[model samples]
Target: MSFEHVFKRIIEFMHADPCGNFRLMVGTDSQVHKRHTVFITGIVIQNEGKGVWACIKKVVVPRKMTQLHERISLELSLTEEIVGLFTEERKNELIEIVLPNLYKGATFTMEGHIDIGAGKRNKTSEFVKEMVTRMESMGVEPKIKPNAFVASSYANRYTK
Candidate 1:
């Protein structure tokens, strides 16, 4: 299969699989050189989905690797900065360059958090508010619910 087909299939499997738990980790194999190769580790674990999910939760790189890891982190962090600095048009331009590889796990990790954490403050209510705001922005009005219910839903889906 072509890379696009393989990528789509993997995403579909992750979304549709009833008994599989998958997590993706992005990193580089080597960092000493300029043209570092990006690596993606897609882990699948199926153990009533609990222990398997934990098993897949391992980082390939240690915290000590600062030079390249930090660089990648900064680049990832810059996405929202660029978005904030430019209007929607310029932001879309920047996204064109940056977003193509984001699913493959290339960008500053901060980008992910900023994309998720904008209006959400410290409280759980704040988190729901932020999520709802995003869904609204996407023309999706989600039903607001309590954290306990949301946690229970996750527990139900993943736990046996």
Candidate 2:
């Protein structure tokens, strides 16, 4: 979908309950196939426990991506690309919706969910610091593994 359309939807969702807590999450995951690889990036807006509006953008590589590091980096790059679309002006617009309700406990957070984990059993563990640093530099809180449902779960489901 176009950025305008997605932004419209997000505004509508936040306007529904300006006093509600909201989280805007972006994540990407990739699946290598016999002939190609599919990458799916998920953009999710969760109004705390109230409701959510989400979408996915897909990118397909012409050849199988076998290098683990390369695949992981590509996934993160895709996620960052999406996050970058929400420029400061656009973010301030979203925040403006809830700004008045801040005194009522309203809050907003933007998170980048990396599919990698720090667990010793996970091969992606080795790259956690590098990826996490990249995400932190983006000015969004970074989440990995069990906490990164957008990349590991939502985006993963569509990579196939």
| Alpha-carbon deviation at 42 in model 1, angstroms | 7.1
- Candidate 2, residues 71-122: lDDT per residue as tens digits? 9999999999999999999999999999999999999999999999999999
Each prediction's Cα lDDT score?
0.30, 0.96
> Candidate 2: where is the Cα deviation over 4 Å?
none
Looking at candidate 1, the ten consecutive residues that score lowest on lDDT are: 108-117
Top candidate when judged by lDDT against the true structure: 2
Q: Write the per-residue lDDT of candidate 1 for residues 56-159, one digit (tens) a residue.
A: 11123333344543433432233222223334553244234435556664331111111122234533343545444543443222333332221123322322
Candidate 1: segments with Cα more than 4 A from true spot: 1-3, 33-160
RMSD of each: 14.7, 0.6
* Candidate 2 Cα lDDT to native: 0.96
